[model samples]
Structure formats: C-alpha cells, structure tokens
Target: MGTVYQINKGLNRPISFKGLKAQYIAYLSAGLVVLLLGFTVGYILGLPLVVLLPATGLLGGGLFVGVNFLSKRFGRYGLMKYLASRRVPVYLWFNSRKLFTQLKIGEGYGKK
Candidate 1:
C-alpha cells in the first residue's frame, strides 16, 4: 500500500542544509518536528510553559545532537552499511544451473 519495497533506492545526495547531506538533514528535521509537536501539545493542554518547554527542548535537543553525532561518525554511506550489517545475510551469489530429465512416452521437458 505504501512503498512496500525499495530496490536500489540508495543515492548519495548533495548537501541540502548548511553542509548536511543525505540522511543528516532528515534526522535533524525529524528531531525538530518532534520538538515542535511536543511543545504545541503542551501549550494546547495548558501545561506550565516554564517546565514543559525546557523538558521538551532538552529531549529534542538531545535527539538532534545524537543524530548529528551519528551522521558525523558514519557519514552517508558508512552509516547505511553499519545499519545494514546488523541484519542477517539472506542471499548468496552462485553461478551455473542446469535441469535435465529423460524423455518419457508422450512427454517432454516443456510439454508437462
């Protein structure tokens, strides 16, 4: 229903935000959006702005910093490789194959 599979989807994109490229911008944006949403919800619920804002700010800022750290440590492609390496290897490449069978009465390989 919604992009159930992706084949060869990885692309090394350029810096789109203040030298942040590829997944870095996405991580930063997601962290900021989360912070904004949390702040908005606290405001709508009439929570004490003094306490709520700082708490949410710390949470969001932590997320942003953590993501930024990972991005710098792994870069675009290395991070992908690191994540992918965690998964089980489901494929092994091999070469050469043949199917052989003796013909029977009124039967052939393709006929059946």
Candidate 2:
C-alpha cells in the first residue's frame, strides 16, 4: 500500500495531485512558449521556419541537459532547498527521515 502526503507552503496548501498536474502543465506551457517565441523571432528576421525548428530543438535540448546536469551535481539537499525557497511543493517516494538516511549512506559509500 502507498501513502500520499500533502505539501504545505505557509497559508497555501496545494493538493499533491494538483501540484503534479501543474508541473506537467508548466513543462507543456514552456515548450509552447518557446515554439511561439521562436516562430515570432524567425518571422521578424525573415528566416525559414525549418531553420527555426532546428534552432528551437537545439536550445530546448541544451536547456534540458544543463538543468539535469546541475540537478545531479547539486544532489537532493540542494534541490530541496531550492524548491522550499521557491515555495514549490516537492513530492518524494519516502518520508524525509528515510530519504536523508538513504542519502547519507549513498553519499558515504559512493564517494571516491
């Protein structure tokens, strides 16, 4: 059996399902925004839409890679701190205590 927990931020408590849905929606919105901006810029510059497509693809790919690299380098604590400060709800598979314990063990053994 799995348990779900609600994430609270100050006076606002967004339902966990809502937060998850919002995150996906945000990603979709970002992609759409990028595409629209690229199209607009390309039109203004008299560039072919085909060229803009590749440029947008490259930019989005690079951004995704960079974000992943940074997140990997920073680890969970860094990500948690960042999310908490930004008032974003973080959903985890386990409770904080178990998560921290696993993190410590993994860090200790995995370090070179």
Q: lDDT per prediction?
A: 0.74, 0.60
Q: What digit string (tens of lDDT, one per residue) describes model 2 on residues 1-112?
A: 8998855644643222322332333444586687778778888999987888788888777756655554455543565567675674455334457656556544768576
Q: Candidate 1's residue-wise lDDT over 1-112, tens digit each? A: 6777745545654555565657788888887887888888988999998989789978977887787777778877788888776673657322333322344655654665
Clashing residue pairs, backbone N/CA/C < 3 A, model 1: none
lDDT of 2: 0.60
Residue 73 lDDT, candidate 2, scale 0-100 = 55
Q: Looking at model 1, report the run of 10 residues with the lowest lDDT sum.
A: 92-101
How does candidate 1 fare on TM-score? 0.60
Q: How close is candidate 2 to the true structure, as a TM-score?
A: 0.37
**Number of the top-ranking candidate, with lDDT as the measure:** 1
Off by over 4 Å in 1: 1-13, 89-112
Model 2: lowest-lDDT 10 consecutive positions: 13-22
